[model samples]
Target chain A: MTFTLFDNEERMAGRAEAALRDLDFGSDEARAAYSELLDAYRKSLREQRRMMRLGDRLQEQLSTVNQELVRRRAEAERALQQLRDAQDSLIQAEKLASLGGLVAGIAHEINTPIGITVTAASILADQVAGLRRQFQAGTLARSDFEEFMTTADEASRLVLSNANRAVMLIQSFKQVAVDQTTADRRVFELKPYLSEVLTSLSPRLRRAGHRVVVECDEGLEVDGYPGALFQVLTNLVMNALQHAFEAGKTGTIRIRARLFDADTVELRFTDDGNGIAAADQGRIFDPFFTTKRGAGGSGLGLHIVFNLIVGTLNGSIAVQSQPGEGTTFIIGFPRVAPARPVAV
Target chain B: MNIHDISRAPTDRSPEIQFDPDACSLSISGASFPEDGAAFYGPVLSTLDEILKALDQRCVTVRIALNYFNSSSAKALMNLFLMLDDAAQAGNQVIVNWFHAADDDTMKEFGEEFAEDVRFVRFNVIPTAVTS
Candidate 1:
């Protein structure tokens, strides 16, 4: 018969007594042996009771430790979530700072064309007043009249052209700036939209003595977030202007776009400047990884570019560079992007 | 009477078992939580019984070092100690060394409890830096 020592003493004793009684023991020595066996069994029962008490206490201590571990894990998770929220706000601030820079750059660009237009209009008004006086006094010779006409013609032409240039600048700036700020999603012609982005960035390019060459086919269109694409292109151009060329040196930045497949379009941005070093190339897109940390690099330029193209635009980007040759960032994305999930 | 030696390998749920008839020594180590305690310990116990029966006032050593064991294994262990106690009563030298980790109070207490149950055999509950 199998019995745990946890069974009550009286029950166990009765079982042992019954077993001994059933056994054929013909001598007193055999009975004494049976009595010794009963004693061992009772001692084992007491041992089991003590072991049960010890096990219960151990189990209680283990439960407390497990609860402590669970609490620690939850605390770690909350800390991690806080870190993520802080990072997201920092990225937002960076985006707004870039947009502010764009606004300042466009304002500076519009000033020159508008200034020339105002100067030409004033000069035309002064010439008209001089011509009126001559006509009233009857001292208007054929040569004087002809000279006045010539001056008027030149001044009006200058005013018209300069005024139109100002209008064009404002138009392109408005489209690009609004798209970037609002993050609008729409179907847009790739060629004209790219030129508009380039126009908005022309002041920075001119100041840096760098030229951008755009080679995109006419009538090619993308059905995606134009604003996100604008941010991506702006960040890329800004990154090249900041790092690709040395100060006071000129470089050519080429942007070429074409249909990679029926569903995808590939855009390659190449710069003919000092290429990135081998060790720095891989970390360029990492946040806060910058060679110009103290001067002006927030290190989020390429990181923002990466997030925009990959996260917002649902695209892929890769870079190929040689230390002395140049750098090329090749980006490929679907012509029709998938819808983004609504953020909570 | 010939008593064969017993050697059983440890698994995820059971401890290793090694019995040497010539030396009259048995060592069980590692964790023991087998699904069926009787099935796992039946053959080993029978072999141990044979060895104890064949001994004539001979000495035997048993080493038990388990990190964790379930209720059923504990019961089997109790049975084993009872058999050793029977041999010691028959005028054979029996030494049982129970090894536990120094920090493991539960196992240490278990060893102490097992020692109290056996009146004849030398049950030594030893605390070590590690349990094997």
Candidate 2:
């Protein structure tokens, strides 16, 4: 085992042999020990590299799972937030609707008295002017005085009635405004509810220069708490009149309701004004979502309307609109009127 | 905002909630499951109470005709039903008819639940529709 390969390349071979001898491979035992040490060193180096690679892969997988978890959690939170926001908007819309109904009814109670008072006041003023003329012409007498007194009294009564009517409407409005039934339920009528709602919204609509034309099927009836519907309609109509038509411009709002198929009552409101945009259609019903930002638009109007129709009314409402065209809202109320209508 | 309450009519999604006063008659129909069920149905219950208290006869006919309502609204409906039932127990003939679709077993079950809470108020579950 001590042979040297220095016959051909004697110089290079002699250097290798010397180097190998310097490694101190003396006997079989010493050689085996050196080889064992070298093999252990190489194995440890390979193991460390393999461990590092495995650790890198494990960390990458953990990071991916964490990212997925964050994404899913964010999605869940978004959904929950949306639900909460929608619920809140729904409550607001229902409250507005109820108040509208009450106001409309109260307004009906006031109209007659106000109308009569206005007429009486006008007539009395005319009579007073006539009396003053007669007196100025030196033709006034005791009979004339008595007539004037009678006229004055009548005028005063008319004034009082008119004032009372105004007071009632105001009171009704106040009641509606301050109503805190974040939760309320009661049974009310259709006609009076609608009437009150319209009356409540009179000023708002009038201020917007929009006119409402109602065509209710005379005998059409259903059982629903009208306040929510009133709010829903008020918001929708006012939205069309005020926002869609632009302030100071006049538009026609048509409200038509009829019993359909004996099992559903359909109420359709169409406005001849600028309609909603196509892009805004899907998001119109989202809470706090609006195209009109910073114009005092809370973006809850349509959201409320949606809640009122779907939540309160337990009905379906759909919107059709085109920019620069007109918007139409169709509401389907399931069942109104008797299966057997009484022969009126 | 006074409570806006109505008894549904008899139908697939309706109840005949009626307030028949000597002065006027009030009826409610359609579905009322306000997102804020409590807010929507709250004033209605109170207003109804006021109206019923002021009426000549405590006996008012209420109909509820709702096609769909959420769980929160179901509570409100139950509250209304209980109120009517109480009025009936107090010597008033309060008739409550729970309406549903014949094919709608869920609604029928709902009607039955509402019917269980009555002593004197006549509770009737009527499925007027042939199919839900």
Candidate 3:
């Protein structure tokens, strides 16, 4: 038997015509059968055509919706990236502002020793001029000359000591200032480096009547980013001075460092001042969270500290405090810091 | 009856077709939305017609499991069922199983609608836990 394929309505119609021709039209039964078959085929064809139109429309709608979703996803991703970039720049600005504050404090601190040295040198110059006059008049007694010698000796000694003090102040200030500005990794004795950071912050500490005591092994060395460490210490000390002690009240901040393990070192910074409230402890490290919102608190200090430790140094920090008792920040990091990703 | 088996592999836009001569079973599964539905289903339909003509009181089983089908494929499916219905009317046992995912109400409705049109074939609309 030959198969005639019915691939479309025209082919089906042609096949129906052929079947009608093969049938005996004189027989009523044959006519009725052909009529029934034609009716069913026409009904099915109508329904199929209706469904075809509906399917075409549905496909068009689906494609349009899919395109819209793709465009919206791209737009949302771009917006998120922009928000992250803005956040990074804000963090950088906050860090620079804190460094600027330290610079001002150190400048004021160096003024005292430098001023004393200048005053002593002026006194010595006046004494030498008087001695020259006395010797030229031919009326200088041995007793006067000996007394002048003693005064000259004391004045010279005062100038030498005060100048040396000024030099020492500048040296420490220079070290801390450079470290804070340039984020370079190096090996340094932890005790002396902490001392240098504290020295740079000495003027603010003295003004607030706060004393910082550092305790660490004399030979305890750390290979890490000193600039990040400087930022962390500066932020913690400033945070304490700002929120801890009341005006004109004296306080002490102690920083103790020890080896937690062969590979890790821990530093505990504790201040004997007002402690954080229990409710505020959880949000203290969050950006723009502060009890002193309008009272000269940018609130980014602790947030910056947290980011530097966790992100840059790959370290961990935790705070413990009780109201009216004190607050202690426990920081732990590797002895040799992990390699940081190169900046893009 | 020396009827050859028909087998068609599934594409991204079309369903798989399998016909077993020994078991007297035909199964079509997967999504069917071919660009040229008539061209795709024409050969299968001709082969089914030949198999039905060669049968002598043989029980033929047809199973369809579709996730989606365009209108052209739907038309082709209607023709296939009609042929099965004709065979059942001529004293042959024909069983048609329409399987749909339990969650797909549209496919279930399509099965019911198709069953209403066919009179002789034993049409069973089955709800399956998994969709093919």
Candidate 4:
């Protein structure tokens, strides 16, 4: 283990000198042996220095690699964070796109009724103008007057009915559309609000032959973001329509709500349709998982629902279902939702 | 020798990467993002390595259509393109097609960036119609 016989070459040289002085220099054999030993010692020192240099170079290389890896890891983390943000914004965009589609459908629905009303009103105006001319020129007849009155009454009725229909459609659209676009908080009654949401979704419901009934206690009020609540309900209703019911099959969606506590509310949405299979029930909330791939399903419906409930409404959701027994989604949240919704 | 296809489904973060070894085609579509870009691309790089090694001077075609990809993914892609370049330099035929949506200036720029370092491989920045 004691590899170094001397601390330095000076000590080694002193030792060698003392040994030479004590040795018999007259013997050539001894002189030769001493010279060989000196050569071996010098070679060992040279080898040691070379080994030290190699070790230093290896350490430097390792440090460089470590630094490169650290930099790369940090870069990867930053990229991942950026990707997450991009994905989140895209999800938000999908939500807004859905709202846009709903608005377009509502507009189309309102247009037909309003168009008929306009035509009826114009016809009635023309009749009035003609009748006024007849009266002023002293050419008015009893039968003509009676016919005019009858036409006026019929036109008035048509105008009134259609105008009322348009007004109702617009009012419903205004309420639900406003909630979809804005995240502002307000105090509102629950039962009527649910009614408005269902009315706004009538176009989809009718198309799918699905009926949604809301059962909430009267005079129950909540101070929170109705927009978030609207989104949650919309997603759930849409999910049931898309997943729970078979195509062209009529299904009943029942939404029952009650106060869970003084500050909390429980809402249960049950659909009497083909329920989710036991295996798929677990991953229904996973993003981009759809049994209806290549169809109209985006697979973000339930995921968005989960996010809105937990993130926006600060609530929890659970699902109970069997293949033939139908599906029920039970959601519980505070009556007063968070002032500002958090991003999931 | 038959090379199996390498396909990964798209997630909220990352895009789908698919390689059809029999067709000598590899495609990347959707969002190119993952928490560990290198790890995600590691198998891709290795797969390319295997394909190139067995290519025997045959042509390999790479088609890339990524709507969005982060910087880390960009790096992984750069490495992949370099590997293709090396393969081409070794006398193997490599053709790389970089597709970007017409309205996506960012993706166009990325295609250009990847194209800059490629010489041996026939690299082309192709403009595609906006999908959504």
User: Which structure among the candidates has the greatest DockQ?
Assistant: 3
Ranking by TM-score: 3, 1, 4, 2
lDDT of 4 by residue, B11-81 (tens): 97688877777677788888765665656776667666777866767778888988876655665677788
DockQ order of candidates, top first: 3, 1, 4, 2
- CAPRI tier for the interface of model 1: incorrect
TM-score per candidate: 0.60, 0.48, 0.61, 0.55
Candidate 3 lDDT over residue span A1-344, tens digit each: 43222344757777887878786688888798887888888888777677776885676577579889999999999999997788778778887788789879877988887887788788888888888898999888899889888988888898888888889988888888777778788898899998888888888898878888999977888998888899899999989989989888899999999989998989999999999999999999998788998897877889988888887778899999999999999999888988872331
Candidate 3: global Cα-lDDT? 0.85
Fraction of reference contacts reproduced per prediction? Answer: 0.04, 0.00, 0.20, 0.00
lDDT of 1 by residue, B12-66 (tens): 7789998787788999999886766667876677667767876898999999999
Off by over 4 Å in 3: A1-82, A339-344, B1-132
DockQ, all models: 0.05, 0.00, 0.14, 0.01
Question: lDDT by residue for model 2 over A1-344, one digit each (tens)?
Answer: 12111112334444645555677677889777766755565566456445644554555566579889999999999999998887776656655664665556556656767888888889888988999899899999989899899989988987987888788777656534542232244444455555655667676676667788887777566665455565677678757854678666788888888777777778888898888878888887887787677776667777777776776666788888888778889988655422332220
Q: Going through the candidates in order, what is the number of backbone clashes in each?
A: 0, 75, 0, 0
Off by over 4 Å in 4: A1-79, A125-141, A338-344, B1-132
In terms of docking quality, model 2 is: incorrect
Cα lDDT, model 2, residue A315? 77
Tens-digit lDDT string for candidate 1 (A85-136): 8778878889989988898888898999888888888988998899899999
Tens-digit per-residue lDDT, A1-344, candidate 4: 22221224546666886777687767788788887787787787667555644554555566579889999999999999997887678687779877886886787788878998989999999999999999999999999999998998999999999999999888878887788888777889999988888777777888877787889988889887788788888888888877888887899999998898999989999999999999998899887777897877877888888888888888999999999879999999889876667866
User: Candidate 3's chain A scores what TM-score?
Assistant: 0.76
DockQ of 1: 0.05
